[model samples]
Target: MSDDMLRLLPWTTPDGKPCYLSAASDHSRLSLLADDVEAAQLDSGEQVLDGARAVLGDTKAGERAVRFALTRATESLEDVLRIAVSRGERIEAGET
Candidate 1:
């Protein structure tokens, strides 16, 4: 199948490579799972953003706290970007 026909799943493999789903339709079981995963990722990203902002706003937050928040924010950013790319591809393919 063409790359456009595949979906970039929310999770990756053990080797840190990207994962794709080849569902025939969006309502398939795998597709539904992916949808749930994507939603959770997005929700997590929002929570991360809120926590990072709180950490940044606190004047007494130590270096370790800032570093930890930065690390979490970076991970959430990667997830959100992946979700954006996946949805954008689907839209461009007229699958959305």
Candidate 2:
């Protein structure tokens, strides 16, 4: 299988484990599922960012709330980075 077919799973197992799958076609079941998950994650992240901004704008917002939002944003960013790096590496390697 080519590295280009490899995908970084958006979510972990029920027990909290990382998962990876590879498919020759993006239309495959696994690939579609991953796409759905990535879309969800991105949507959720956007919401989180909006919420964070609102909180930051509030004069009553506490440090704890800001910290929590930062933490979640960091996690979402990490997931995005993982996906980007995986795809970038595969492309750089010219996987076929």
Best by TM-score: 1
lDDT of 2: 0.76
lDDT of 2 by residue, 1-96 (tens): 364456667777899767778666667888788778788878888888898888889899899998998898888887777667656755765643
Question: For every model in order, what is the number of clashing pairs?
Answer: 0, 0
Query: In model 2, which range of ten residues has the least summed lDDT?
Result: 1-10
Candidate with maximal lDDT? 1
**Candidate 1 runs further than 4 Å off:** 1-4
Each candidate's TM vs. the true structure? 0.92, 0.73
**lDDT score of residue 43 within candidate 1:** 97
Q: Write the per-residue lDDT of candidate 1 for residues 1-96, one digit (tens) a residue.
A: 243498888889999899999876888898899899999999999999999999999999999999999999999999999999988888877743
Note the residue pairs that clash in candidate 2: none
Assess candidate 1 and give its TM-score to the true structure. 0.92
